[model samples]
Target chain A: MAVVVMGDVVQLLQRQPGEEGPISDALLLAALANGDGNALAELYLRHHLKVYRFLARMAPLDQSHLDDMVQNTFLAVRQGAHRFKGNASVQSWLLAVAANILKQHIRKESRRRAIAAALTEIPLETTTDETPEARLARQNSMRLLGKRLHGMSHKLKTVFIMCDLEGISGSEVAAVLNLRQGTVWRRLHDARKQLRVALAEYMEVDT
Target chain B: MTRCPGKEQLTRAISNDSSAELDAHLMECPVCRDECEKTRKLIEMAKGLPDGHPTSQTVTRIADELRATRPERDLWASARPGYGVVLVAFLLVGAAVFAWNYVFYPPSGPSGSANTNAERRDSPKGNVTASRSAIYTHSIEHKGYAFDEVVSLREGTVTIQVTPLKSNERFMVKTDDATVEVRGTVFTVVATNGRLVKVSVKSGKVHVRPKHADVAILTAGGQWRRRTHPIQKPTAVLPHSPDSGVFPIASPEAASHLTKKTDRLDRTDKTVPAPMKKKETVFQEGWSLLRKKRYAEAANVFDNAVSSSNGKDLNEEIYFWRAAAHYKSNQSEKTGEALTDFMRRYPQSPRMDEARMMYGWHLFNTGRYETAKQEFESVRQSPLPHVRQNAGLGLRRIEARQ
Candidate 1:
C-alpha cells in the first residue's frame, strides 16, 4: 500500500487505487508509526481540516485555541499511531484524540479562569459582507449555540457532535468513546431532546 | 394518539438510521415527525457555525515541531512471542536476585540510607543541605573524589558547600530559572514560581546562568537576582547592598556606580547606627516591589514616580516601567492606556520598538488586525535583527489571519 516513496502526497492521492498510486490512510499511519515524517505530513494535509472543524465546534468559546488543539491532535496522532488497532476508522481515532485534548484544555482554562476571574475579551471576527443587523443576528445565534453546547455535559456533547454533526456512525463513536453502542444512542437521544427545546426557544425569540 | 416511537428510535431515525418500523411510525405520527424535523434543523444550525480554520503558519509550526522531535520507539511491534517469554523469565530471575540482596544485605552506611528530604555521602559529609521546601536528590560515582553530582531544586532554596574539586569533577545546582555551576564553592539559591529569585555565594565563586540571561561568575559575598523580564547579563559584579541588603543590577554603568558608592559607604561609615539608614527613592521602592512580583503595587508606585519626576530620561523610564507593570499583572485596560500614553509622550524613546511589538501582539490578540498591522510594520524597520525578524513573522501572521 506504501507505493510512492518520494513524490508529492497530493499527486499520489489523486491517482486511482488500482494504479498503485494512492496510499490508504492506514498505510500512511503505518509509515508514520515507523517514523516516516513524510507520511505524517501527508496524513496532516488529509485530515487537519476535519480535526480543526471538530475542535472548533467543541471549544466554541475560544476560537484562538483551535490552532493549538489541531497541532496537539496531530502530535498525538504521531505518538499513538502504533496503538491504532483498526477497530475504528483513522478519522474516528483522530477525532477521539482531538476530543480528549479539547477536554484537557477546557479543564485547564477553567482552572485558570477561577484563579484570575477576568481575561481580556477579544472582539468577535467580522466579515466585510455582513450587514449590521445580519451580523448581530448571526453573532446572537452563535453565542446561544456556544452557550448551549458549553453547558451540555461532556459525554452528551461529544456523542452529539460526533454522531449528529460529523456524521460518524454510533458504533464508530462508541469505539472512540469506549462506550457501548446502547449508551451512545441513549446520550444522543438526550442531546437531541435538549437541543430541540433550545431550538424551540430560539425560534420563538426570532419571530 | 398511539404512543410514539422510543427516544432511541427517534434518535436513530433522525440520524438517518431509518428502519421499516420507525419510518412507518414517523409517517403516521405528526408529533414524532415534528420532533425529528426540529432536532435535525438544530443540528444543521450547529453545523453551520464557522469552523476555526487554522492559518498555514500553524501547520508549518506543528510540522517543524514534529520534525524536531523523534517518535517514541515501539519495542513490542517487532518482538516475537518467544522473545516475550524469555524477557519475562529474565525479569523474574533479576527480581529474585534483587530481592535476595535487599533483604540479606540490608544496607547500613549513610550512603545506603535513603531519606525523603535529603541525600548525602559518608565521606562528603555536610556537603548538601536544604530546607523543607526544597526537593532534591544526589548520587556519587566511583571516580575518587571527582564528585559529579546535580541537585535539582524545583522551588525553594538549597545550600551547598563542596571542597575544591579535581579538574574532572563537576557539580551543579539547577533551579527553574537558572543553573549555578559550582567551582567547589559554598552558595545558596532561592527559586520561586519557576524562576531563580536570589543567589548568594558564601566562601568561593559560582557561575550562574539564568535560563534567559548570560552566564555570570559571582564570588564570595556577591549576590545576583532577577527583577524583570529578560534578566540582563551582569557586566559588573559587587557585594550585597547596604540599604536593602539586596543588589538590583541593571546596566553596566549603573552597577559600577552603585558598587563604588556601596564601597565608600562601607569604608567610611563602619559605625553608623541603624536608625540613620537612608530613605529609598520612589523608583527604588517601585523597583523592589517589581522584583517581588507585586506588579499592581509596583504599577501604582511607578505612576506616582511619573508625575513627580523632574527629568526627561527618568520620566520616560517611569512611564515605560509602569506600562510593563500593567502588562505583567494582566490589567488589560490599564496596560493599553499606559502604552498609549508612553508612545505619545516619548516618540523617540529607545524602548519604543519593544513597546510597539508588545502593543502589536496585544492588538492582534484582541482582533484589531489593522492597527496591529501598522504597529508591526513600524517595528519591522527596527535596527535590532531579532526584533525585525519577530515583527516580520507578526506581519505574516496578520496577513494569514486576514
Candidate 2:
C-alpha cells in the first residue's frame, strides 16, 4: 500500500469509488478534526455495521436505542477526533468510546423490561429445511442466550463480546477496556466458563 | 494421560488459545473433548446471533444528528505548525491596535479643551451633552484601560446623557455641594450659588451625594432638590470649639484660607435652622477644595479635622472625605491608612457602602483581589442602585483579572 499523504487523502476522498486505494481511518479522522461532515458520513458508511453488531452483542438495544447509541458514538467521534493519537486502530478507539456510551446508557436505564423486550426481538436465522417447531426452539434458545449474556457482570460480558463474539484481538480488547492483555484473556475465560455452566441444559438438548 | 484440562483452560482453548499439548489432550481424552465441543457449540450459537445491521434511514438519522451538533470549523486544526504562530501574532497585533484606539488615544472634546460647552461631545467611554450655558470642565481620568469622565460644574445647568460605562469607566457630575454619580444615565444637574441646587433623572438612575447628608438615589422622573433656606451672613470667626452648629468651623489656619469663601458657604448653606458656634471651618474648606479636585490640599484639611473634630457624625463625614481625597490624589499609603481607620471605626456608618466600594478599588488597584472581592460583594447590597452597580463593575474587574 502506498503511503497516503494528507493531500492525497483529500484527493482520494473526493474521487469516485474504484479510483484509488481505500482511505485510512486515521486520514478520515484527520478530516473529521477539520470539521468535515463528509468524513463523518464516510466513516459511518464504512463502519456503522461493525459498530451496530458490536453493540448488539454487548446490549440488547431496540432499533431506536440502537440508532441513538450509534449516533452518540459518532458524536463522540466528532467531538474527540482531535484527541486521537493513532496509538491504536480507529476501530479500537471507536469501540472504547462506544463502550463508555453503552455503560453510561445502561446505568441510566436500569429497568430489566427493556432488556427483556430486546431478548425476544433478536432476529432468528433459519434455513429452508427448518421446521416451524425447530425455528421456535432455536428462537427460544437464542433469547435465553441473550438473557444470560445480559445477566453476566458488565466487565465479564464486555470482554466476552469483544473477544469471542466480535473476534476483536485480545490486545485490541485490552486497549478498549484499558486493561492488560492478560487481564482481558482472564476475563474472557471466566465469562465463557460462566456461560458454559448456565447453558449446559441447552447444550444437552442440542446434542 | 495428562490431567483433564479445567473448564477455564478449555474455555480459553475454545476462545483464542489452542496449544499443541491441549489439542493432543483433547484428542486423547473423550471427557475433555466432549467438554470442549459443548463449549464450542455454545460459543457458535452466541456468535451466530444476527448482527442486526442498522438500516439506511438509521444511518441518515445519525448523520443528521451529527450535522446538527457539529461544531464550527477549527481554523488552526488544518494549518501547519508554523501557521499557528503566525496566526497568533496577527491576533496579538489586532488586539494591540484595538487597545491603542480605545485605551491610549481615547477620544477627547473639541480643541483638546477640558472645558468645552458643545451641545454634545462624544467619547468611547460615554457622551456628554451639555447646555450651551453649561459651565463645566470635562476631563477623562485614566486608570489603565478604564477611565472616569468627570464633569465639574461651577455653575449653570448641564444635561449629560451617558452611555453604559464599562467595568473600568465612571461618569460623575460634581458641584461644590453635591456629586451625582452614575454608571449610565441621562440626567441634568443645576448648580448655582456654589451649590448643586437641583438634580433630575431623565433615564436610568443616579446617586446624588449632598454635602453633610446621606446619598440619594434618583431614578427616571425622580428629582432631588436642596431645601430652600434664607441665605445668611458668614459666622463671626471665633476660637476652635466642639459646639459648632450647622455651620462647619475651620481651624485658625484653615479659617484664614477659607475666609474669602465664607460668604459662598453661607449663601449655599441649604441645611439650616441651627445656630453657628466656633470658627474651625475645616470641613467646609476641605469640601470646597475637594470640589475643585485639589485633592492633596483637601486631604490635608480633612486630616486636620479628623483630629480636632468632636461631633461623631461630623467625624464620620470627615473620615470618609479624607480617605476619598487621599484616594483621588493617588496617595496610596495615606489612602490605605485613612480608609482602614474609616472602615474600622464606622462599620455601621450610613456611608459604609461608599466607603467599602472605595476600599474595594483601593485594594483592587494594589493587587489585593481576594479582599477586594469581599468588599465589592458586601457593597453589592447597597441601598443606592448606582453604588451597587459600581460595586458590580468593581467585582467584574476583579473577575477579569483572576
Fnat: each model in turn: 0.55, 0.56
**Residue-wise C-alpha lDDT for candidate 1, range B1-402, written one tens digit per residue:** 456888777888999887888888888898899878778778877887667677788778776776667787656855689999999999999998777545543322345563222232345422888889886666554343234567777777888887765454477877766788886788988777555777888988888877665567788888776644223332211111112322222432233332222211111111232342212356566666776778889888887666665334355556766776776666778878888988998887766776787677667656788998999899888765545865777788788877
Q: After superposition, how far is residue B119 of candidate 2 from its true place, in Å?
A: 36
| Candidate maximizing DockQ | 1
True-structure RMSD, every candidate: 42.7, 25.3
lDDT of 1 at B349: 73
Q: Which stretches of candidate 2 lie over 4 Å from their true place?
A: A1-20, A85-87, A110-113, A120-123, A126-128, B1-9, B64-69, B72-402
Taking the tens digit of each residue's C-alpha lDDT, what string does model 2 give over B78-172? 56889888889999999998787556654343344432213222343456676677788888776555566888998788888887765556788
In candidate 1 the C-alpha lDDT for residue A191 amounts to 84
lDDT of 2 at B75: 56
Task: List iRMS (one decimal) for every candidate.
Answer: 2.3, 3.1
Worst ten in a row by lDDT for model 2 chain A = A2-11
Query: Which residue pairs in model 2 clash with each other?
Result: B249-B280, B249-B281, B249-B282, B250-B280, B250-B281, B250-B282
